[model samples]
Target: MGLFGSRGRRRDIPNNPALLAAAAENPGGSVAEIDPAYIDDPNGYVPQEAIRGSWLVDSGGKLTGEYEENPRHGVPQDDFSRLTDPDHWLGWLGDDPAAAVRKGIEESLRAQVADAVVEWVKILDAPRFLTGGRRHTEDEQVMLVTRAGLAAAFALSVRSTQHGRSTLLGVFSWVAAHLSEPQGRKDRTWFDLGVGLDWAGERLGERIYELDGTGGTVER
Candidate 1:
């Protein structure tokens, strides 16, 4: 049983009992029963993209506090601030204690960003429009241009040993950027492979990509 009883998923409606009661009249109703008095147009549906964006941004903000502020990690909030500050660059570590701590922090934050990206857009890998394999390939291509990876791409902007410049961040940035845009199915370049790569070039700069190719981004 789910939160809405035996239904496989909850209807996308507000939590108001009156609204739910009115919506229950439809076979799979969500806000269809919403009172006309409260809405400008009775036919309008909520934009799910907005909801997804809110969740992702909110999750990012939470990461700043939830994991970053825990005293046990030995990573000071000020240190974390310096690490995430846009003016600084992120790097990799092999055996240093500080490196390990920063690595853990970076890995956690990257996962949070990646998870948010995945949730933001439910990718449709099926062969829609007869694009076949290209449709599935599209999602893979889009995952490549994470801006965090670009920031860590050995640029001259700002440098640091903090793991903030990991490739995961880059992936997050790309997905977020795509979701951030108001694109429609009619937009020919919306999911174009070249467009995604071009965005990557702009975000990543030319150097880091020359060093780190697109081979490992899709892996765990």
Candidate 2:
């Protein structure tokens, strides 16, 4: 009995007992890893590596909890602040930063589907970071941070007319990979992040959430 009542193989998230427990009553998809470097500090500081917990998606394709069993630090206090030094992004943007970003997106898509074919895919924008602003909102506890504030937080959204499937770890792992690939041809002189997908117009699935490289989604 999967999310949409479609029978599929049972999958598990390795070393994530917390995530496993959370998915106990639901169908499973791909298992993405949680990166410790992307978590925020107790003082509301967004470091080069600041992201916390895993975003839970239920069998019904609804957004659920956004934290782990025990949080490493408290929620961020300020809505605007320097996430990290700009120089930190130099190492991430390699000879082909844009392609790297694409690879990360493909990785996330692969994580969700095991046997199902993607058919076609689309992204709203290239990968870039959210420098400073109330991106996560004052009430939201998930304070997304990247290397030198070089990237923004993203969530994986899958839409289908039929339901009953759960993407195990969401897109946490996909977001982690993008941290090393900024928006640039072959330089790190600038810092920004962007990654989004929508398959609604096709009619097989509709856009439940839009990816604008910013804002909140079911994953990331």
Candidate 3:
């Protein structure tokens, strides 16, 4: 026999009046029970794209078609100019690290500046950072900080040897500077950094995995 009664039989009714009163009070409220078959539908509703138009649509209602082809607008000119200028894309060290390191403390300063610039770029793109739909429009400051930060990160990453104290200090100093910046405190910046770091780490891990596999086995 079970605690209540027999296995097949219904349990004995509760003898305690207080327990019965509590049970009566605890009646299940209105619950719209959904059919299991309704949830089992394979062709369920799926959300569609929220935005339909092209990203390049201008405020003037003009499409960005042939905009790249127009030299008069300076779009093509800017693109070509950037392509011609290798220095624009390449970081601080460029093709030469010896020269950058020889520059000494200035290199560290430049790294801090580079980190600030990266933060600034991310801030510019972020909507939450904007005040009344307007971002910080100080172009000169933006350019200056960006250049400095880029130079610093590049110098530290390339010139600083792994086992050296000075190298570690330089790298940490750059990170500190990045964190000290106003935009760096923002959640968005941290989120972006996390994403970037994860991606870079993943790529490096994949490369290491490949190298380890190659190091282990040789096919006949």
Candidate 4:
């Protein structure tokens, strides 16, 4: 008799014999296809070289030509340097080129988030928080502070995702809970607890380990 319940019954789990054979032959074979553009010149500066493998994908469903882990030519390096350089293209655009470039960057960032913020706010139902408190209904200050905090959290999550550490779901949950209270004043202790739960969920989702006959190992 089977210890779990089944007795003298064939296992229902599907086993791919071909895949098993392939794995046995070539243990390092990857199931996912690596795009050539990303594999070639990940640095972008060295465009002549063959692209290397990358984890970043673009809107077109192609792997980004730029590297994700540690891009050789990236915003913090080349782009920022150019923006700050005296003889750079942006330097020629204005008298106070540095300030102008900074302003332009801010504007661009604001524009990028404008639509996203609107959509997010719509989904959040900001008006619901105004019901109980006179501070929330009469004075716009409470609402403004709440909106700003939520926006800051959203921006932080987006920035974190660029580095492959996305906390959007956590931030969203915290913001939602915060917005549920009257006068838009979130209970920090409660919010922190909620954030912890969200973090646990994230960790659980990323877990790849499974138990086999020998021991526990990473799945795929």
Candidate 5:
């Protein structure tokens, strides 16, 4: 039996392993035939080099390409950066961007989620925001923000994923809990989350995180 907190991810990213490999770097790499290593262990390795349309990933999860002091590339080479570009939205959603706009989530909400993803990346990159000015490696930032970003994604999933109805209460509750964090407090775009917490308070008779009164939340 699995121990407490010893669990699998509700969802694994880069649904397509081949997509994570920068096949172009390998001369003959193509979507039809990606690196054999990725095929064998989709979650075990990643693109060794930066590719035009590839993501940086390893056994643990998705990661961004090398962090830059002055990144000038117009195209994003990693999952985190891709979040900011709507053009990549379709690829992120398995070549079906429209599908991402689902039952309880509208295009606007989807935009917000994407924005949050970008913001989450910045928060992760800037470790000093939480630790009072301490420079950290990109890996450290990824470790810190991956789960939180995924957790925030849960709120979006509550509206978009097939498990929305089943996970509605749980997902919103989880989101609320995260919204109480220092980073969450600093993020003002999550007004939708306030609406969600209000619903929880009105219906569930319980609430863990409350809206910040300083206009960071939209309580109705």
Candidate 6:
């Protein structure tokens, strides 16, 4: 017996009266009934690349936050002054820490040269840092150098992953000319780069590469 006192029969009814009323208003047909208001003009469609800024709006139709600019529209340049500013890096760090490290090195090199683009960015090796006589597992001392156009060097001490972003512990840069043979300095630059080159030669080196005709390097 069912609730309606019928034997072996069930009633198809909505518990909410409002739903029943709403269903009654809809026409019973194979094709779905769509509201004419939903048909939008095709010219209003905006492509992802064309969008530059976006503003946050609340449900009450009120402006919420400031306009945020799209970082992908231009060259990915890190603000030197805000390097240690954690807030600036929020969500900007890509998933791969190694790629971020390589970009940091390449950008630093690229900034120093004119009409020259940095390519074949690689992290030869990353040795862990020592803090107060104790090994800090998170920190890495990265040494990188550039060869073409001009010899530029950069040493980055970074936290591989800190609060979902790579924190820059320190950055050091110099021209390799100061350490070359005639200067009578320890030519350790070549030694360091030699090891990295040897390691890169053995494997398929994953590094930054420039697009065929575009002035910018491929992002990721």
Give the number of the best model, judged by lDDT.
Answer: 2
Give one digit per residue, the lDDT tens place, for model 1 in 30-54: 2222222222333432212211111
lDDT of 2 by residue, 67-139 (tens): 2322343432221112122223433435654445445544544555544322222222222332212224556
Off by over 4 Å in 3: 1-88, 91-98, 106-167, 172-220
TM-scores, each model vs. reference: 0.17, 0.21, 0.13, 0.17, 0.18, 0.19
Q: What does candidate 6's lDDT look like per residue over 95-209, in tens digits?
A: 6434544554655544544333432232212221111111234653522111101112222222112222121222222111111123432211111232332343222112111
CA shift of 62, model 3, Å: 74
Of candidates 6 and 5, the better by lDDT: 6
Instruction: Give the winner by TM-score.
Output: 2
Off by over 4 Å in 2: 1-91, 115-146, 149-220
* Cα deviation of 45, candidate 5, in Å: 12
lDDT of 6 at 217: 15
Superposed Cα deviation of residue 136, candidate 6 (Å): 19
Cα-lDDT of candidate 6 = 0.26
The lDDT ranking, best first, is 2, 6, 5, 4, 1, 3
- For 1-220, candidate 3 gives per-residue lDDT tens digits of 1111212222334354543443344343111112222122212321111111111222343222211111122111101121123333223333643333334334333454432211010011101101111123665333222111121211111222332111111111111122224464221111122133324333332332231222211111
Total backbone collisions for each predicted model: 3, 16, 8, 6, 0, 0
CA RMSD (A), model 5 = 20.6
How does each model score on lDDT?
0.25, 0.31, 0.23, 0.25, 0.26, 0.26
RMSD of each predicted structure:
19.9, 21.4, 27.8, 22.5, 20.6, 21.2
Error of 2 at 37 (Å): 42
> Which stretches of candidate 6 lie above 4 Å from their native place?
1-94, 130-220
Measured with C-alpha atoms, the lDDT of residue 145 in candidate 3 is 21
